[model samples]
Target: MPLFVSMTAGGPPDQVTRRAAHPVARKGINDSPSKVIPTNNFYGNLMLGNQNQGVWTHPYSLRWVKGTGNSSSWGFGVSHIERSQFAYGPGNPNKYFIAPLGITSIILSAQELSNSTALTTDSLEAFSVNANLAVSAQSGPLVTFPLVQGMGFFTGVYLGATALIQTDVFFRTLSGPWTLGTSLKYKVLLEDGRTWLFYVHSSQGYVNPQFILRSNTTIQGPSGFRGSIQVAKLPEGQSNAESWYDWAAGVYPVTGATFGTFNNGSASYTLSWQKGGDTGKTLIMWALPHHIQSFNGGVGAAATDVQLYTTTKGQATLVASDQWVMVEKLVTDMGFTPWTPQNRSVTTLPEKAIVAINSVASSELNQDFAPQTNLDSMYFSGKGLAKFAAILIAVNDLARNPGLAAAGLSKLKTAFNNFVQNTQKSPLVYDQIFKGVISTAGYSDPGADFGNTYYNDHHFHYGYFVYTAAVIAHLDPSWLNQGTNLQWVQTLVQDFASPVADERFPFSRAFDWFHGHSWAKGLFESADGKDQESTSEDAFASYALKLWGRVIGDAALEARGDLMLAIQARTFQNYFLMDSSNKIQPASFIENKVTGILFENKVDHATYFSADIECIQGIHMIPIMPPSTLIRSKAFVTEEWNKYFSNGRVDSIPGGWRGILYANLAIINPKASYDFFAQPNFDPSWLDGGASRTWYLAYAAALGGCT
Candidate 1:
């Protein structure tokens, strides 16, 4: 029952021909070179496993540091609990559709932890995973799950083999449900910012597909600067689940819809779009919402032959214009409106209001990374397990698909090119960001601040941004051969990482914090306790080192690179309570396990918040050690290779583990070959994202790049 196959000769190894003892049985966990480490303080004595204590053995479980507490499950809890009308479970049959657990997480700080608490902080650095987990029972499904909306009166429109967005929902259906089923995909639009009308016009195809929602990404002022996003809503705003989503794409029309101006101060062709089934229309500028108007048909803006199906709860109750006139207001906002532009202008959202709106929007985007969210968002620490897992996924995709890697690099190049083009003619105050990242302040309310742009702290992420950008660049030197994208990438790297980003310590983006300790111990780099923090810094640190490494091919930098991998291992092994079973004991529910990084020890830890944990939990290792390390280090051929390889039994969840548990292991370890990648059910070519990041991974995998 527990036999293994070699998988060396392509296709599934014939069981009778290639049967053998499992790789794990032949080689112990340490047989692998790198692991996400766990320790009292990630770099503390606890990692030495001294201070003798009972070896709490749960087959897969390891102790948290010395002896803080016991962890039976590695956050293998339900992400979405399906409850009904307060029914008793004894016979009521209540249940939970628990998102599988194949991940573990550790949070890191840019600033030293001073408080005895875990959660509160200013900004974040990155995310990584625990090494023990990397070597532990890799579990869960590698195939991404759809962020599906339950559609009624209809059963399965999006259930076939076609790819769709089903994870990071645009919005949750906690209350009021939808009238029909709908789905969202992020790649269908362009980021030019000038195509509001056309974009809305194209959305007509979606109007009939249940209820699909797209956020009004053209964030001008959160004020009367009205635009509409449609969600699968229920009939007449009923709370009953009549029309849930079949499949949905969280489209941020902001970047996808708008393209900017040229050196001469003119933008791409301006577009006029009929908004929301023809009841309204929109105008976009510089890629943001310039105006939205409704044509009552009988009185204003002329009549159209096109019949319009209106949302009883429409995209906008009112539309805004530059004149500050309340042509119409969201019925909830209690305002009036006339159909014509002359009758419908409004002032920009107040300063304070705009910043708040922007913040809410950006926060959502940062957390959106599942199959399609930004892998590197400010919301995730560079020290979580899930994030590292995501990196591994990217690596696997690169190893499998040539097109994805090339696309990622090309997209990164295009984004930077747009930034360069925008800056050449505009103010130096332009926002330099990835396709959908927003660092601006909120603008949805009155009295919002639009002046003090988040350019300063926000720009720090640019280092990591450029680092990812550069990886793709190296894949194809020709990518930089002609365009300013390559030039700006080089400049941005210098702009943020060097003596420019931190000023005092040019190589760091260390944020400052106070009031901390979680049974963690560390040799204070400074008397006041200021030192480099975080395991997920691999995104930044590895990039910097690799950039320099590739340029000069130095050995020292490679050695330094080990710190990221080594420390991540310590955090997973020593920091948290790993328990008798191999699962990570979640620190908090609402915080997504990221806040746990603030502690130095395992027990007698800082205060924990009950609300921080989400319904679902996973190890936050996806982002930290992006699979780029797989290539950087040549350990792929060894026993550790099993972590990413499989003999068709990769999904052997002998113990409890989840996420892309089996598939990721097969892809990361060198022994796992293209045969593993070629499985029709597990194709890497069709993945999701604002843009498929697989394009970048393709280069890393030697698909089309010089590697």
Candidate 2:
């Protein structure tokens, strides 16, 4: 189907479309490596089982066809071609043609053994005929084929045939119960043929797909053979949508035995059938491209399409839940429909999910608060501000008891005033970096420690400040321009994200557009070069800017933050979060490690803290993000939890990390995360002293996805 019937005058503007390249033809028939186009610029190399994995459109197709004989004879072919179809996009009109289809076909016939009769086979000539379009002409990977001579062959004693078509298409690989729609036609021309069966396979975006049998043809000796369309799970996997997520999803068709789960890679599929013994029967198969499974989740309430509030001011009267009302407004304005409780598990989280999150935010609303002991460290101090912000946010939640609002505001004011006054009084220098190092027992200088070893965490430290300021400003809009004291908070945004160059600060200092992410490297000198070790903090920085931009009415800055997020999301998935095992980390670190510090040339799965499983898991955990942002995918969450914290392991872990673990769980398994935090012992000690347990609980409650 044509995506666009006609383009506007200048054609669809070359905005950010899914990134892909013209298909590359195969160099040879058999030995050549599979050539694949990336699914998206951000999440490239999905590792879908097929050689070429992506979404392909009209006038181009990549194909793989092969034949195997039971008696030491086999043939294969691979090709790329331009289809005769109407295809056009943007300034590039009708430029969908690729030349000299990179195609090769080969056949080999070995000397027959004593028991096997001498096979009269012209393997080379057979492959040549097979490669010609006349025998098996195809427009693209998706098409319905009519059985023809040599389209699939079972010639020469004990021969069989197979053909696979790979397309530039994608399926919902994240947490799937995907459905594939197709009109398949096939036939088995075997009167005295040996046992033969057809196979179908697909990849789950991270790993190769399993080659599964689609036919019921068993090797237990062929009966009176009659072929018909069939829908079978094929063994370890399922063909029916309802049973897709089952643990026993994958099975071996040959032995009717179960293996591991199916690799749901959506890149490619192959169909094959074979005959052995004196049977000279040929198996023919055909398929037409149909709908593939997409990620599914529950729906949320209807949303309005406009800004939350005409002005960011006058929100002081509105508590946190009231603020979420506006958040829902902003979210809808940003072009996202609110998610219903039923479909909240997809990557796109709805406002209802946020509201449903369970947390102790209400409990901390009235509690008196204090700063962390290590105020000298920006990380600790900034978190102190975050605690105030969380409390203020909690006290204002519509679901919470609002009697403490007046008192909460007063506490917020006092804390902000004290925080600004103390910071100005301190002798800490704020130059290219925020340096306030002082010698301590564990380390000579805890303040300067960020600049030294954990050099890439500036975003993490500063993001807390930015988040806190945005919260206060949201609650009290006048805070931005009314007082000289509040000016410091506004200046922080300028210092960090001003597009223009300022001698006092660099432009968007930490972010790197080339990498589509921010670099965490600072004063630390190392041969490995700069890298953003903490993926969550990198996202946190953008999240802060987005919130702050909304508060200060900087549209450009806010858009920049959104774009940064878009790019960061893709980059994080492709690099920081491991999908299929690769050389970036050892097998032990695969799936278990979120990239700790990814240098240009080196990748380490180590964080600044201890390298325990909890720390590894916590490296990418961001407990707080506005309800609008979908920070991580459930696929990633499932892997992280299963690999590190599954079983009774979450119990032995102590301190704030326990809370952090629950927060991480909120992404996919929010109810479980909520249950963990809801425990009576889930107290302030479980929280990083820098954050308010009350707010943390509320944040989790909002994301817990259950009321």
Residues 154-224, candidate 1: write the lDDT tens digits.
00111111111111112222122232223221111212211011011122343322223223211111111
Q: Candidate 2 vs. truth: CA RMSD? A: 22.0
Q: Which regions of candidate 2 deviate over 4 angstroms?
A: 1-368, 398-402, 422-449, 452-456, 580-589, 627-629, 704-707
TM for every model, in the order presented, reads 0.29, 0.48
lDDT of each: 0.23, 0.38
Q: What is the lDDT of residue 29 in candidate 2?
A: 24
